[model samples]
Target: MLTSLAIRNVVLIEALDLEFGAGLSVLTGETGAGKSILLDSLGLALGARADSGLVRAGETQASVVAAFEPPAGNTRAAALLADNGIEMEPGEPLLIRRTLKADGGSRAFVNDQPCSAALLRDLGGMLVEIHGQHDDRGLLNPRGHRALLDAYGRCDAAAVASAHAAWRAAAATLADARATVDNAARDRDYLTHAVEELSKFAPEPGEEEILAAERATMQKGARLSDDLAAVSDCLTGSDGGLAQLRQAARRLDRIAGEDAALAAVLEALDRAVVEAGEAEDRLAEAAEALSFDPARLDAIETRLFDLRGLARKHQVAPDDLAALRDEMAAKLAAIEGGEEHLAALEKDVAVKADAYRAAAQTLSAERQLAAGRLDAAVAGELAPLKLDAARFRTVVAALDEGQWSAQGTDRVEFEISTNPGAPFAPLAKIASGGELSRFILALKVALAERGGADTLIFDEIDRGVGGAVADAIGERLSRLAESNQILVVTHSPQVAARGAGHLLIAKSSDGTVTRTGVHALDAAERREEIARMLSGAEITAEARAQAERLLERV
Candidate 1:
């Protein structure tokens, strides 16, 4: 429930602090007494749109702070705070403050922690609902009717939502499967050809580098082999170095006995021949080692070229061709087995759809039963509000499959027939401004303890009606206040007299500056305020007596 509201430098309200209690608190004053300003200030604190015009004429900025004390059992507000990462102690008050500068800038805070205005607005919605003739945020919107009905009926909407989610998940899976299978079917021929080509070529990792290195060595060896052959011929020829050395050594051996010098010369010549022979043998071995068949080299070159060509065609490195081969083969296999997988997905989707339908039907049934009860309840309220002949209906109509949502497959709307023979039409179309307010009140009275904001403020709900009708409205409001905190802004003395607490909004001028003030009326003060409401500008003895009697009835 709203605990208090504080305003600073807002329009005519220089500074005002008003504390509230539970039950129906009424704010009453003459016209132009700044009642609207008070409401606007509260709206601003609740994250309504900020305007520079709201600032006092001489002030640079305006601010409002609204404090609320949530019930111990209310987890919705706690969950909302937790979601936004704002902390409040278990029993602490939730304070929302909003500041508007003259420069058209604004800021919002919850529990003095800076927060987005949107978050503050959301929290405000959970804590309070302000209704008036032009209200669109609450019961006026048809979109919220389903949730309202479910709340009223205690329906298992979560089950329907869960089932819908499952159905959507299954449907999405089926769609993806269908798309995959269709694409694969379109590329069936391409996949088959790719797999066959990659299989036949059978490239391996590191083969490219090995073949390249071997090709380089073989090319170099071809050049070296020619030079080696020439060297071998020179070493083995009849007049080559080894032959000539051997012949000279043989001649020197024959003359070696004649002189010691000739023996030394023969030994040196033999050693030279031996060294030459060893060189020739080493060269032959090297030539054999370096030797490579031209045909084998050609085959290596062809294999390298083919590997590069395939890699280019597939947009991959030659080493990756092996992995690509496996991928294409897997795709081909999936295509072959796609129909069976698609059938299974279809079955799952059907099962999920059936489940969703069952849950939605159950929810719809609950809503239907609740709607009947709601209509009867509202009908009971209509007679006292002077709409005895008007009919209220809760239309829970089924929607098309394409329009189905987590909210279920029904569209709920509150319709009314204002006359006996009139066809029921939408609330907005069937009721006059005064009638609409009464109808809204009737619906609210019926839905009082079911679910809604803990604090409900109705602005001028008893505007057009008076006398017994005003008293009836007051009685209903009192009844509503039994379960929820209610605030009413009214001119009707009967309505004003029924308040657990009363506030008088008044404007005063100190010659230069005019300001609006709100005073919480005491018992005697309330009598005078209500008397003024009954007697207009001047309070009379008769009005005072009537106000006293009205208070006694309450």
Candidate 2:
């Protein structure tokens, strides 16, 4: 329940603090006595859009505070507060404060802890619902009707949502596979061409490095070929030392027996000739090893160029060409096997779709049943608010396949008929302002304990009705407060008289400044206020007696 409201420097309200209690409370005031200002202040605390014009004439800022205390056995408000990181002791009140600066900026706080405006709005929703002529939040939206109906019927919406999601997942997976097959079919010629081209001479890994090294050696050999030829000329050409060495050896051998010195010289010359001959053999081997092969170099360069060109064309390293060829071959193979794969996916989708359809059908049936019961309950309430001839209905209809969603296939809309023989139409389009308020009140009374929010505020719902009609509205409001707290702003004295607690809205001026004030009426104050409400500007004795009788009834 909304325990209290405080406003500071907002519009004509300089400073106002009022505490509230359980059950139905009424705020009564004369026209333009700042009754709307009180609601605006409460709305500010509830995260309504801020405006600089709300600030008092001389004030730099305006602020509003609303305190909510959950009813016994209700934890939704506390849970919401805790989820927003606002700490509260067990049974502690949740305080929401909103401050607007004159410069078009605003800040919000929950339980004195700074928070975003969004958080305040969300937490506020769990605590209070403010219904008025132009309001679209709360129970007005068609989107929430299904959930509310489900809540009223105790149906498992989660189960239906889960099934819907599973169906979508299966459909998405199947669609992706089908798209892949479609794209592969479109690129079939390209894939086949690529496979054929790569298969002819799939480049081997590391073969490029080996070929490159050989090419470098062949180039170096070409540079050294002339040097090698010069070396061969020095070692065994016409002017070489082999002939001289042989001649010296033979001369030494002939005089070897004449003296020991000649024999030693002959042995030395023979060893030198043998060593020189070995050197000549080694030079010949080196020349043959360094011999250049232009044809072999040309073949190697051609192979390397082809490999590099293929790598660039295919956007892969030479080493990866082999792997790419294998992958393309596999994709082509999958094209052959794709029909079977797609058939299996379609089967899975069918099974999932059937399962989802079953769940949705079950949910739809439940909604139909709940809707009937809801119509009856709300219908029972309408006559008391003086719409006895009105008809209320909940329409549940299936959407087209194109309109299918995770929320299932049914569209839920609230409809009403204002006359006995008229066809029912959309509530928003058919009902007058006063009639809509009564309809909303009836719906709320029917679903009082279904959706949460411990507090409900009606902004002059009894705007154009009085006497028995106003009395009926008061009775229903009082009945609704049995399960939820209710606050009504009214000019109806009958509605005011039915309040368990009363607050009077009055505007006073002190020459320079005018301010709005709210006062909690005591027993005597209540009598005078109710009489004023009944007798207008003059509170006559008959009006006072009537006010006493109204209080006695309470």
Candidate 3:
């Protein structure tokens, strides 16, 4: 149930804080005293669309916070909050806040932690349901009629949902397989040719990098050949370092043993001769390693171009050529064996479709039974709201095959007849403003526990009728309060007096600033307010006595 609402700098309301209790609460005042403003503020916190014009003239922003304490066993709201990662514990108050900027942008928060407006709307839906004079939801919206009937029937919605999903998934698979077969059949020749061509090249992953690196090295090798050859000639040709060292060695060997120092010089000359021969051998090997044939360069270039051309044709990188070839191979295989596979998929789809049909038919039968009961229940509530002659009907009709959905193959609508001889018509098309409210009240009272809402707000539900008719609407509201908290904005004194808690919306001005205020009424104050509502602008002894009798009767 909504526990509290606080508004700051909202249009006519400069600052306001209100604590709400359980059961039916009524808000009453003169027409322009800001009763609608109060509901609007609450709506803002309930994730309704925000407008900068709601801000007070001198304020830069308007803020509203609504705190809700969910019932002990109601975990739907808790689950949603948990899914969004908002911190909330069972039985703890869930505070929803919205701050509207004067510039037309607003921020929303859950328990003071910043969140998106969508999350607030989702959570608010579970916490409160607003039924205003213009509201046409609940039974009036045909989209929800089937589900409402299912709920009344105690049908397994989850099972139906699962069956429907299974059928859809199977159908999707069959469709995709058929599409693939159709496309592949059209391109069978091309796919087969591509597979054969790619198999001959048999491109391997990472081979492109290796080949590119080898080509780069050979290109550089060609540029360095002249310098390498010149170095080789300088180190190993006649009169080069190796030949000159050997000549010196031979001369030293002839003068060996002429003196001790001369013998040492001959030994060093012989060692230099051996070392020079080794250096010459190494230089020859280095020249051989640098050797490349000019024709080989052309061959390498041709191979590189062939690989690039194929990559371009396939719209893939050189490295992805191998992957593309494998994909084409699979497509060819699919064409070769497609008919058998498609038959198997078709069988699967048929099986799933049969299962779904059975479930939907079973559900439809139960809905038919539930419909009769729902109509009877609604009929019981109609007479009490002074609609004894009206008829409330829940129509469940078969839909065409193409109209089948996850819910079922049925079109459900709530239709009504205002007179005994008139034909039943769609509720929205046939009911007047006051008649609609009364009609909705009957439906709501019949299906009050459907959504398990924490709070139900009715803005001017008793719009067109008064006296006995007004009292009857008040009686139903009181009955609704037994299961959920209800708030009604009313001009009917009977409805106002039926409220367990009463609030008066009043407007005042302090010379410079005008503001709206809400005050909880005490017993004595309640009597005065009720008297004023009954007589208008003037309270007489008779009105006070009548208010007392109304209070006593309750």
Clashes of each: 0, 0, 0
Give per-residue CA lDDT, model 1, range 1-554, as digits (tens).
99999999999999999999999999998789899898888888877888899999978999999989954555777888888899877788888999999998999999889999888787777788888766666677787777788888888789999999999999999998888878878999999999999899899988899999999888888989889988988888897878888888888889899999988888888889999999999998888878889999999999999999999999999989999999888778879998898899999999999999999999999999999998999999999999999999999999999999998999999989999999998887767566777888899999765667888888888878999999999999999999989999998988988899999999999999898999998999999988888888788999999999999999
TM-score of 3: 0.73
Candidate lDDT values, in order? 0.89, 0.85, 0.85
lDDT, residue 124, candidate 3: 72
Q: Give the candidates in order of lDDT, highest first.
A: 1, 2, 3
Q: Candidate 1: misplaced stretches above 4 Å?
A: 70-92, 112-120, 196-327, 430-434, 536-542
1 versus 2: better TM-score goes to:
1
| TM per prediction | 0.76, 0.71, 0.73
Model 2, span 220-313: residue lDDT tens: 8899888877766765755778768888888878879999988888888999889989988987877677666899999999999999998999
The CA root-mean-square deviation of candidate 2, after full C-alpha superposition on the true structure, stands at 8.8
Q: Which candidate is the best by TM-score?
A: 1
Candidate 3 accuracy as lDDT: 0.85
How much does each candidate deviate from the true structure in C-alpha RMSD?
8.0, 8.8, 5.7
Q: For model 3, where is the 10-residue window of minimal lDDT?
A: 132-141
For model 2 the local lDDT of residue 361 reads: 91
